[model samples]
Target: MEIPNRGKNIMKTLCLAIVLGGLALSSALQAQPSEDTVSVPVSARQLRIDLPDAYSKMWPEDYRDLVANYSLSNGQTLSIISRGTNMYALVDQGPPHKIVSTSRNNYVALDRQLKMEIVLGGDQGASGSVTMVVPSRSLSDGRFVPEQVVLLAFR
Candidate 1:
């Protein structure tokens, strides 16, 4: 009789433990982001950026009509089109932009968008990261203010 009661108590305890564990897992799953889209505020649309795969894959496949035109610090213009792993850029209808110089983590790109004299810095261990900056004329100072909108990370 005592052995039977002991077995019944063990089963009850095991059942309660399983229920509690399931509840914990349910809460954790609810906290994770959904597979389709990330949670972003409506007001942050300008700050919204598509994933790398979107730029590398979807842009080439579907959104190839979207052209990025950048007014360089110089007098020329830079036109960029997203293809695959490599981004193609044409400088004032000139030849394809090539890597002029490279450092351990930084590169000095001699293109119209990335002016030859400008030095771009990045976070530690960052490579091939491109950030889109939206420039607006300041009403107070009458100067161009650059606000970073989207950042795309590439290996």
Candidate 2:
């Protein structure tokens, strides 16, 4: 029977630990974002948030069943469509705009309807109001769901 040497066993264990440590370090490094994108520091993990609101290659002609009970029409101007107290946003041809910011959850698209946690960096317009809006986000099922879109303007 070959007796195990305490010194040899200790060295072997240390060598194995060093190898595992190197592998773990390399894995962590690989998980980090590429050099190009900006990184947002979030607890538990890092994330990359890219802007330039995702384009809708195919905006369903009837993406949503316009409220039969309520319809916005009669050739109204964009101003008529968008005008809020806190955050003002409307669908436009150019890149979408936002008057609200995002938080851990619940993306508020309008600021005029409720108190905002963060203010916008740009001008809030002449209404003496603060605007903050986020681009519309859609789910895998192709349904539009903004972080927060207050449809009711005080009835």
Candidate 3:
């Protein structure tokens, strides 16, 4: 049995259309922006604070005006206290750091001497976490090191 010429031509045309459709679909997909290439807007503000103590201070015996307290996963306690218009973070009875609010629930504390930044974010008066970006030291010369990010969860 031999296929008709007309039928062969129709089959060839269908195959070509399918091939072209596939190519078009592939090209359309390629033209789309990749999920990995995301651009986020960043805003930087310069803040100057004057305090009697360092950014972080030990848990004060007579501390007042408590705002929120969280317990970290590493058996550490983090307390946020308010004094006038500023907020302070006292971690595990350690030194308190003056954390400046960036947003409704986002706060950041910077140590210029150590070139370290600590970012705290999450629902205020609820669960939250702290992220510390600290500068790393080069093993060879103890200088020219990159920054290391450390995340600590709290509740």
Highest lDDT model number: 3
Residues 30-149, candidate 1, lDDT per residue (tens digit)? 655876645444553243322222111233443233235544422334555554534455544545542222333222224423312222232432124433322232433564343333
Provide the TM-score for each candidate, comma-separated.
Answer: 0.23, 0.20, 0.39
Cα miss at 119, model 2 (Å)? 59
Backbone clash numbers for all candidates listed: 0, 12, 7
Angstrom error of the Cα, residue 2, model 1: value is 99
Candidate order (lDDT): 3, 1, 2
Using TM-score as the measure, which candidate wins? 3
Q: Clash number for model 2?
A: 12
Off by over 4 Å in 3: 1-66, 112-125, 133-148
- How far out, in Å, is residue 110 in model 1? 11
lDDT per residue, candidate 2, 1-155, as tens digits? 55346334333333443454465557656766886644433553221222224322212231111111211121111221122333233322222233333432122333233222222223532111212222345544776544332211110
Over the full model, what C-alpha lDDT does candidate 1 score relative to the true structure?
0.38
Candidate 3 residue-wise lDDT at 123: 41
Full candidate order by TM-score, most accurate first: 3, 1, 2
Error of 1 at 28 (Å): 62
Q: Candidate 2 — worst ten consecutive residues by lDDT sum?
A: 67-76
